[model samples]
Target chain A: MRLGRRFVIAVPTLWLLLFFMVPFLVVLKISLAEPRIAIPPYSPLWEWVNGSLKFNINLENYSYMWEDSLYLNAYLSSIKIAAIATLLTLLAGYPMAYYIARSPEPRRSILLLLVVLPFWTSFLLRVYAWIGILKTNGILNAVLLWAGIIDEPLVIMQTDVAVYIGIVYTYLPFLILPLYANLVKLDDTLLEASRDLGASRMSSFFRITLPLSMPGIIAGSMLVFIPVLGEYVIPALLGGPDTLMIGKVLWNEYFSNRDWPVASAVAIVMLVIMMIPIMILRRAQARGAEI
Target chain B: MSEHILAAETKPWVKGTDRPFVRIKGITKMFGDLAAVKDVSLDIYRGELFCLLGGSGCGKSTLLRMLAGFETPTGGAIEIDGQDMTGVPANMRPTNMMFQSYALFPHMSVEKNVAYGLRREGVPKGEAMQRTADMLGLVKLDGFARRKPHQLSGGQQQRVALARALVKQPKLLLLDEPLGALDKKLREETQFELIRIQEELGVTFIVVTHDQEEAMTLSTRIGVMDAGRIVQVGEPREIYETPNSRFVADFIGSVNIFDGEVDVAAPDLMRVNTSEGPVMCEPVAGLTARQKLHIAVRPERIRLSRTPLEAANTMQGVVTEVAYMGNLSVYRVQLPNGQCLKVTAANGLHEDNPITWDETVHIGWSAAACRVLVK
Candidate 1:
């Protein structure tokens, strides 16, 4: 039985080592090498010198990332934007998930389907559609003008606000789905027990419902924050030039600047920065499972 | 008439001077087109362990929820401790419920779950902690206070739920099938523990349960419900011995009911002409001659003997089934009229010479043992 279980686990372990670990090793190796003007665009980690192998590791790429204000600002702004977007998504998704979870069984499935309906269209198409809605002469401005709510067109497109809107809209289902699963599993009688014990509706929600759904909050926040930290398409399509993000900088370096070594360094550093939350999420999930 | 009046008035708790602590007046709860709890009125006195006993979908739980203020009555009013509870929210009500599932907060420790009510009442933290400790000690769960609910055993979790509900010191404590989750042995043990805590705290308790034995053991008075209506409300022994209807008799315990007509309805004694034979029973007032009625006799009340006895209500029957329970032996006696009557005999020192199946037996019961149901 143990051997059969080991065999069952071995397949996925081998696949992950080959597909994920190997690529990560390659990226790490490239990040330690110097950028070149050749086709491959980066120097090899080891080279033949006088018929003997000599290592050519470069620390300049790492130091250059620290020296540049653009890279530092991009990292900080990416973190800030992702954090804000995650918070917004949580604020919007919690009530949606709670309502769906509390709804009658027949309506619950339909509400969940509505949450996931946006995924039927391509993510890029949805982000592109935001452009038509948020632009100065777009649908939102046209509606506001027609309604007499505003006289001037709103300058929302190609701004930080647009990026935030796009991120929240795109990742809302990811947040709501996990939260819904968690909230639906909550025993209704626990809330009643709280109320029965003299807790008002608000206090019961905070003390019982909120604390019980912490695992879901952590899971959902990580789902939104990790992806938004590396979000490229939403910012590229909706954000202005002033809206600096690490994903956009990495894209410019690898694709436009053709600096694969510096881009690899950026990718490695992003991974390191994301490692903290990922570990925290994993620990929380483990603890939740134990409970 | 005098015996009836004495029986009604002699119950010490039902005196004229005693006012009910909780009065539910003509309360009706309707769910869409369905009346889950019909027009029902009941009075429960202070410090009484009252049980709402019924089967599933019989509205006992609905009545308990109405008492907890979780469900509002479509009509009628509730007054607790002389205060109107109409439209009062569950949080605002002076009552707490221990849920059937024991709904202890999974995220909190036992201490926190117990202290949650006091915390919500804005009690001081130190005082709340002290009360929580005292409640845990009352339930004998003091050492397990720091552990989360999932970490405790089922019985321990039930105790925690009890402690949590009781710590608020609410005027009324509602328990919905509190022992339903425990195994048989644990359930029996916890039933007494619950009664002990209830008495010690002097809290008025309204427990809802479908388990008749649980109700019998725990309740000072039981309100038997059926199909959204309360059929009878009395002490457990009164309910068992003098059930108002066949439904109450059957619902509470094993009963042998005989459909019959009143052969004679006199002031002193009445006789029922059943399919088996004519049965003489104690007179029930307002029963007229030749009127259709039913006679309910408990299994334990019927006597089983191998030899015939010259008794007023005696029948010769062959024992078809003999179940040798450790404490008692149940015999299914099939009379010549094709009716089967259940009789339970105490299995004392005569275990070796037990009554076997197919043995002809004489079954009899005193006239006082039989309940004459007019409905």
Candidate 2:
């Protein structure tokens, strides 16, 4: 390669190596070590004993994670929750994005601003506020009870329902922003032409609008799904003891249990699990670009 | 009104059916405070390639959209195939439109795009596929069925759009500037292709275009619109040769217009006094002596010569500008009164008649060539 092209390519590759690959290598190294009560809190994978070199690569942490039912349950439930939340976000975001894209001029800009306006406040504070709204005898239940819609105050707080609500409310903007950008570039005439060709309004949307917005849907799904899979914040606050997520498991293993080696093993496994969807979405996006 | 009768007499389709295939009665459309189409009424015969010709925002497109059921008229009615189309949506209407943008579905293959309408109508899959293939063959895009819209050229995309619209075999086909996207040579070919397809299917076609030459060559009749109102409707030849008003004459093609007044009025012959001199023209009804009106003479009708002819409508002018096109030569002759007249003479390769710049010439046209426009 030419010097200029090589230099242009080296920048991002160098940054990724320094920040991502190096840190990941460190985690891999730690995941192979045994727990120690001494200073650094983990036995080294290699060290010189007396004159000769001693090697001790512990596979105990990984074996324990594979054997434990809690870890298995956490991984399964995390995937399910992420998939369901991503779908809910897509269904809720698609219409808002479509409406904003079709709106005229200043109103379009205003609606887009409103979609992103929630980003201005602190995310932690917003999720904390959901606690007040979703708890028993809270605002939602209070309103429902007063309106005679419910016989009792619902036990929504510390449940999967509250967790889903929290995740959707926080991550919805992530989906809408990309979907809106895609929908906005769609030509209005394509839809009109569909109708002109004897397709009804519903038929036109599926045949025209939905297929054209596939790239946006895939992108937004990845943006929400990838992060929600490892999400620790919402579930920790709004979910009960019955809720099983890999993020909370990794957190408990790392901080409360003081088991760095096991935590590193859990982190490496989570990283591997997350990579599968990322690869799939990337391939889908590339195919969409070809079309 | 007489032009309508004149147009109707020459058309076999109009004579075959006493009623028009599509009838628009006082249809008007308003956008906020601005009226886009206003109280325009027209009748289009079956199998006739009708063109709504106008400048930008002259309501030609608005009227076409109303026919396709894309836009609802603010007032009045539209009847197609003897059914009133007041509240019908575009999908349910017996009409299909080819948009000016050639809005081919970017994701779908050409065959799928063509088969979309049939699929919507619950046609059998095998029959829909057959019709799609046939439509593609009709548009000469048989080899391009598997390609996406973006993979095709602009002309090919236009053909795909045409095939997709025509696959359903609509009673009325609305084309919004059908040839506006193609190059001149391609447009000429497609114009005939479109006419051939329309003739083969015997479907009524209504095209909206601003290019007058395209309208003249492609449409059986042209409706000239201006400022939200249709100024006149007639056959292409009638629109060009006997335009009813000054606006129609000026809008259709180049013409030398003179503001004149009636010196004598009769059914057979009339003499009009103009700033240049006295002008004799064919009969113009409802004219009194000394009444004001405009007279128009087409550039091609006028004869240019070095020597003056003993003609009834002859004027002497200096050739200020000369443009020699390959087949014809056009001269802009300036009269003594500062009124300029344009005359086009065909260049016969064998003849040695040459008229040039700064040459004193006499421009003349017969009385029959002159047209009297009331407004």
Residue-pair clashes per candidate: 0, 0
The sequence of per-residue lDDT tens digits that candidate 1 reaches over residues B264-361 is 88777788999998999999887778899899989998998888876668999999998988899899999999999999988888566778889998
- Candidate 2 ranges with C-alpha deviation above 4 Å: A1-18, A45-59, B1-17, B263-271, B350-353
Best by DockQ: 1
Candidate 2 residue pairs in clash (backbone atoms < 3 Å) = none
The regions of model 1 sitting more than 4 angstroms off are: A1-15, B1-13, B264-269, B350-352
Candidate 2 has a TM-score of: 0.93
Q: Report, for candidate 2, the interface RMSD.
A: 1.0
Please tell me which predicted candidate would have the highest TM-score against the true structure.
1
**Residue B337 miss distance in model 2 (angstroms):** 2.8
